[model samples]
Target: MQLAQLLIFLILFPLIAAFFLFLAKRDLDRAWIVKLSALTIGIVSVYLLISTYDKGGLMVSGIPAEPTGMIMFILEMLIALAILYLGIVHKKWLVVALIIIQSAVMLYFELVYAHAIHVQSNLFIDEFSNILALIIGIIGSLICVYSLGYMKFFHEHHPEMPDRRPWFFAVMFVFIAAMFGLVFSNNLLWVYFFWEVTTLCSFLLIGYTKTEEATNNAFLALWMNLLGGIAFAVAIVYLAMFGNGIMGLDELLASGKIIALIPAALIGFAGLTKAAQLPFSSWLVGAMVAPTPVSALLHSSTMVKAGVYIIVRLAPIFQSTFTGYLIAMVGALTFLIASGIAISQSNAKRVLAYSTIANLGLIVACAGIGTYEAIWAAILLIVFHAISKSLLFLSVGTVEHRIKSREIDDMNGLIVRMPKIAAMMVIGMAGMFLAPFGMLISKWAAIRAFMDAPYGFVFVIILVFGSAMTLFFWAKWMGKIIAVTSDGKNIEGEVDHSEWAALVSLAGLSLITTLVFPLLSTKLLEPFLMENYGHVAQLSQDNIIIMMMMLMLLVILPLSILIPTRKHRHVSPYMSGRTTTHDMRFSGSLGVQKKTVLSSYYLTEYFGEMKLKTAGIWLCSALIGIMFVATALQGVIL
Candidate 1:
């Protein structure tokens, strides 16, 4: 098939499948349909990549420039109206004010500023695009597969409700389609359109359960993203006015015209919102209230990626701006803050959510650095984090399903009840936590990048401290699960076949990828970086050896089973020198024992929602204002 057609198919296959699957309803087996759809999308994505391999890039001519812009304008107005209606209905004065101001700004910019906007390359593919496509396809497909198993169990647990699997899968497909569109779009306008589509999908998906918390979280997500959409719209309008028909990404980068830092800062602001940087990070953390699969797919793999993908794409354009330095600071700070908070959470999912935010923050910081090395690190981090994190979440979900809880304390001896899943968790955790794994290597790259930057010294401190905190929490969790027991009956391992299939595939992937890390770095990732980022670093043998040694100390050698180890005697957790048989509770006066429950040390009094909301809103608003002021000033000067 032709490459353009293949690209279209890759973008549309899931959506089309979704429609059919939704309509099929009770007549179809939902798992089969979801798996089939996922497979088809993955296959098409692979074909598209192969076809576009040697070709520089391709553009499609079917969508006209002028009409696309007009359509986008109308869509923006419609979405704004919908949000306005929501705000009015919910009596959220803040949402109303934000939306109205954004709407007015967009209207004025479109009417007064937009000039000739033309892009010859409509559908361009590059090494970065290929990497994104691979991630979206492969990781996304695995998430879909895992969801098949997950949703079945979910419905079984909540059997009273009408099955919404059809609608859920349908929206998921559309979400993936939008992601593909976003990555392949050369034109900023098209990218924005896809960006809004993802926002819509996330809103729908987050609210799928229709519980009060789900609905509220979904709205929060919507409002936060609407803020981003506003920034993006503003950037688009200004770029069109002064940019003089330069909308294609390659053309914009080549122009080398550094307008005021703030417009691009606005663009970066939009990215932070989407990436869930710092104060905006709560939405992603709250998203854990939704289905585990959604968390695995959106937070771990695809939607969040869209945010950093934009930052990386625009890295060169914003490379020399003060806003650029600020972007790096924001990202590093986010990494530090989010990781600090993650250490306080014992809710397994919340810990994963915070960890996700921290990792993405690192990726964003790397992109903000805008160096060849940092960009490479960002991309590699994306690749590894997606796989490892998704696997971890899925495994956790399975464990939660069996144990009926997500608390780390409840999972103290998880290795005994669910050995296979626990083993997978260990591997996944190692991939994320251990050295020589891609995440640590990428982080190492980030530190090197930060050290090279004159102004990012503070960021290095934050990064180092934050990383240590992350290790602490993950280690605590890991140690608890593998806590030794003298009883021979401690190990009881049994799990469903469907669950095993998904878990084993992901776990195997985590291990095999690490074993072949050198090849992956040298072959696929390094070549792609050279082609796209224009500079290359030696994948030094010494560096790899050092990482390998660290991996031995942190994960590999410790985990390698030697001489069928006997179980150690179980002992009560240390508590003020008291000993008791009860796992959590301790003996009191006269041997009268009181159950002592452990909950995560949520430092709400300090970092609570109420404490942070006002500050977050104020800071983001100020940032938005700075963007506009800078843009207006640049406009007057130019």
Candidate 2:
């Protein structure tokens, strides 16, 4: 198939599938429709990856440019109007104001300033976009399949709430479609159009419950993302009016040296907001109120990835400038503080949410550094983080359904209760922070890149401490899941097949990607860096050997646990001669029986969100202010 035809298929197929999903009434019909859609998308995405590899990136240009622009403008306006209605209905004055201002700026630009802009290439596909597509298609489809089982339980648990399953499924598919368009779009306005689509989809998904809390959180997300939308509009205006009227990414990147810093800073600011860096991070934390599939989608592949995707795409423009330094500082600080905060979270979903934000910050920092090595690290982080985080979220959701809680304290002896999910969770958690996992490998690469960059010492220090905090939080969770007291009742049969299929597939992917790290680095990462940056940063053979050794350990350790062993006598814990024989209880002085209890140390007093949130927010807000001021000063001098 031609590249243009493939792009059209990828961009529109999901929307068509979403329509059918919405129209389907029976559960059996919905299941078949979703499975077929996911299967088709997955197959096409793999084909695109292979095609891109063989052809070495594809560009479609110079056709339907005018009509595309008009269509995009109309769609954008419609989105704004919908948001306006939502804000007014909810009595959210700030949201209404932000949307109006953003829409006005966009209209002025589209009607007046943007007339001179002609995007030579409306669609550009490269290794970067191919990676993102793979993520969206594969991980995203798995999440959808998982939701088939999850939403059933969701409705069962909330029997009083109306079943909005069709709306949920339709919106999820639309989110996937928008992501495809966002990643492949070369025109700035087209990117913005798809960007707003994601923000709208997230608003609908987050507020799917229609409860007071869900509605408020959804509006909060809307306004924050609208802030980014406003910045994105300003960027277009700045580019069109002051920067040679170039509005396509190819043109902007090709002429990055001469392009104004103000626009770059504006776009970078938008990325920060979309990625939920510090001051704007509360929305994502609150997003845990949504269903697990929604959280998995937002954190893993679609919503937040769109944010970093834009920033990473524009890395060359901001590299080594004042704007770049500030971006790096904000990302590093977010990484550090968010990791610290995760240490205090007992809620499983919140822990995953904070981890997602922190990892994204690291990716943003790498983009800000904007060297060949840093870009490599950033891309690897995107890929690895998507797989592992999606797995973790799904695992947590399944656990929550079975245990009826998302609190870490409630998951005591999870292995004994839900052995299959507990094992999957262990793999997911290990992939997050342990050696031989893709995330840790990427972090190691990021540390190396930082050490060689301009602000080497400071960034390296932050990376070290932040990584230690990551280990602390993830290890505690791992211990909670794997801690076995007795052979508890198993729940292997209770989980749906669809849920198990997604979970087990993701688990395999997390490990398989780590095993193939070297090949992945050589084929995808190396070629991408060389093509884009004109050089490849070599990974030491020694590191590859170390990864191999760790892979061996990963394989062996699991088999050691699963394989049958010689039976041995078990004994209860000795409690200073007061221990009971049956349940490991200890006798009290008053002859009252007591059961022993164990809990994970959250260290809330030191690492609590209350203690750290205000400071982190203010510090990041100040850094963002300095960033724009410096950019403005540079614009003045230029």
Candidate 3:
């Protein structure tokens, strides 16, 4: 098929499937439909990548304009009406006001600014977007497939709650479709439309249960993202009015920061909100009340990723400017504060959530630097974080269904109860932790880039300290998963096949992506960078060798554990005083029988979530205030 045809298929087929899935209430039929749609989407994404890579880049032409534009406008109004209805019905006046402001801005922009200016390329593809497309298509579809099993089990567990799998699966597909549109959209207007679509989908999915808390959290998400949406609309209007009427991404970038930085700052502010930096992070934490699959999709592949994609896309304009420094500082503070907060989380998903925020902060910081090395590092972080974080979230989901809790303390003996899921979770943590692993090489690259940047010391200090704190939380969680015990029984056999399929696929992907790191850099990443920076970033031969060597050590160390060892006399595990081999019991006062218990040291006094998060919000709010004032002053001079 032609490239445009494939783009159309990739974008439209999911919506078609979503409609069908919404209608089909039967369990068996929904399963087959999701599986078929997922396979087709995943394959077509690969084909799209090959076609785009062959051409280096391509833009779809002859796209139906007036009719397509009209359809989008109608759809936009419907979305606004839906959100407006939800807001008013729920007595969420703030949400109502925000949606009205954004919708009004959109209408004004469309009638006054958008109509006269013609955008020849509404959809385009390049190597960078291809990477995001693959993540959305493959990883995202896998998440949907996993949801098939998870939602069933969820319903079984919460028999008190109504089954909303139809709505759940349909919204998941729509989210995937919107993401595909967002990454491929060349026109700023088209991007905004898709952006709002994701916001709507996330709101629906987060509140799928219709429970009071779920509904409240969903509205919180809606308002925060809608705030970002309003900023996005204003940015587009600013560009249209004063940016030589340039609404296409390429045209905006060509106009340089002289014309684009102000709007870029506006959109960058939007990115900060969506990406869940500092104060905005409460929305994502609230989203955890939704199904695990929704959390995985939002945190790993779709909503938050879209936020950073915009920042990274606009990196060129922010390069060497105060806007970049402002972004870099926000990202830096976020990384440090979020990492500290993760350490205090006893809930496994909350730990993952904080980690996601912290890592995205690092990626945002890199994008803000906008150096060749930093952009390179930023993309790598995006790729690996998606795979490993998905695996971690899904693994935790499976564990939760079996163990009946997401508390890290409850999972103390997960290694004994569910080896398969536990092992995957361990690998996920290890891959993201400090080691010869997937996330490490990327941060190393970021460190190299930061070392050369202006105010480099500030970036370096935050990254180093924050990364160490990152290791602390993940190691604690990994320890819990791998902790051995005498009480738990094996339940790995009970995992649903669909969930296993996704978990195994993501786990394998995590390994494969690491194994192919060198080839990926030389073949895919470098060539892509050549287009923008006029050269490619490279690690020295020594550093490359060390990474490969460490990767080998990671492989060998695992195998070493699996290798059979010579039999030796059984010895009791140490538990304070004298311990018996059976039941992990130790002698206490008067030789009374006692069972020993070990718990993680959360250090809540130092890294308390409420304290640290509150401080982060206030500090980050101040930083954002400073940036806005500074950016507005610069704009006034023009």
Candidate 4:
């Protein structure tokens, strides 16, 4: 009964809420619906977490299979038809063809190939699923709540555009539902169904504005994901044909030894697209044009996450193979290049987007390594990155609202303009690369894990350089925000409380999670690792102490800014004796007063998008080609 209730709450509740939110007409109605739904989801997710913690894990089987499979099949068909319609309307023949092919392939597989396959357990619950549920239900719902405040300003900023807040909120809830289903299901077919739902939701949300650019970018996202969907479909077919009746994730994992290389390679290819790894990363970068909450949801907690989640799920199967090595190298290359590219970007959201890609690359690398420690690092990265990135995206969105720009230069001395949000941004930034934070700890573990792998030095080199690039870009952004300049504006009260609530909660989660890293590692991550691998990876006590010390600095540094301080003396900039004003200005040779200005060094000439993107895309494409060729060769040999 408890399992049934929890499952319904986690999987079904948001969907029901989505229907109500879609019908909501007034702001008041949307507000109540979003708040109530968020609250309910949050409560249920926490309850589920507590229950999972108490039980260590839970697995429910013997669900009525026929009806569920039929429903999933119908929904998949509807989603494909919807995509086909959009493709035709947009005149995107590639999308239309891909959907048609995927639909036909899925139909034949479901109706013919998998007609007699009886997957014993359709739903599986464990620590990993529980963690993802917590992320999707809690962080995802918070983003929904954040959207409530953000969409108002969004429309205000673009009065010329039609209001689609109802549709937007409804899709957001639907995304949460889809994510819940994606993580919880053990059956591959069910996972694929939810996967398509997320793809559809992202398409709808990305194209919400319906501008030509939004439409084009949405189609790009569509066709690329459709390509992945085709790969996923092929993988399912291959699995059904060659898997010796292995129909579910558990069975596949259990029978990892005999699984064919083709399905794994196809699935990895699918994951590459979903995670927005190089070659497919342009879609995520383009996603910034969508609303900030959409960026937060897609990049941080939902869409791109599904990509890494699938790769990580299949990690055990890919471990130690030639295909695995290629996947790891691809991830490492992406990490190095994406971080380098971030150095050239001035758009704050784009920087965040690139950083997200880089971090997901690291996670993918860890998954490909597929050792106990590597998988541990991957899961930890997932948890930490989701919290920290969501906070940063929300912070950037709020900052954009205040300054009317998303550029790093525009954020100069944000310490003075929006001190509270700046402080939150600082925490979020520090969490991304600084010590004592979850991301840094996860990276540290990843480095160690890579060191233990075969031919690990190559990955180590990429990771080292990538970490340096990460530091360079993040520090520059941090300096821009916290810089003390005379020309500062105060814009504190302009932001809504709804935004503040979500930001503060995420900021708090970042810090608290950092503080409790040891406990989390011990209780959640360690047990999961032990249960799966029969051993647990341990962090050194000395490192733990250092992490605690750094965490203390993280807490104090932000608080120092918030608390009033009289100990420091203020001084004006030391201009030459020819100073013309109290502000930093100087008398020129021609007797004209010139205001002083400072800007970040972007080095666009060296690290420009045009310089790096094409080369990186080709390199990653070549690597993917190698992966597939090698997989095919292996299959032929076997």
**Residue ranges of candidate 3 with Cα displaced over 4 Å:** 557-571, 579-581, 590-592
lDDT of candidate 4 over 378-470, digit per residue (tens) = 999999999999999999999998899999998888988899999999999999998889998898899899999999999999999999999
Which residue segments of model 1 deviate by more than 4 Å?
54-116, 259-263, 485-496, 524-533, 545-588, 592-638
Better of 1 and 3 by TM-score: 3
> How close to the true structure is residue 473 of candidate 4, measured as C-alpha lDDT?
97
Badly placed stretches (over 4 Å) of model 4 are 54-57, 567-570, 576-580
Query: What are the models' TM-scores?
Result: 0.88, 0.98, 0.97, 0.98
When summed lDDT is taken over every stretch of 10 residues in candidate 1, the lowest stretch is 485-494
**Per-model CA lDDT versus the true structure:** 0.75, 0.89, 0.88, 0.88
lDDT of 3 by residue, 1-638 (tens): 98788888899999999999999899999999999999999999998887777466677887856777778878999999999998999999999999999999989988887667778888888888899999999999999999999999999989999998888899999999999999988888889889999999999999989899999999999999998999999998898888878888888888876788889999999999999987799999899999999999998889999999999999988889887888988898999999999999999999999999999999999999998899999999999999999999999999999889989999987876887787778778878975667699899899999999998889999999999999898888888776676656789898999999999899888877887788778777888788878879876779778877777777654344334376424356776557565777888889898777769989999999999989999998998888888888877775
lDDT for 152 (candidate 2): 93
Error of 3 at 243 (Å): 1.6
The 10-residue segment of model 3 with minimum total lDDT is 555-564
Report the C-alpha lDDT of model 2 over 521-624, residue by residue, as the tens digit.
Answer: 88887887887888897778998998899888986654544553877345676778885756657788797888877788888889989778899999999999
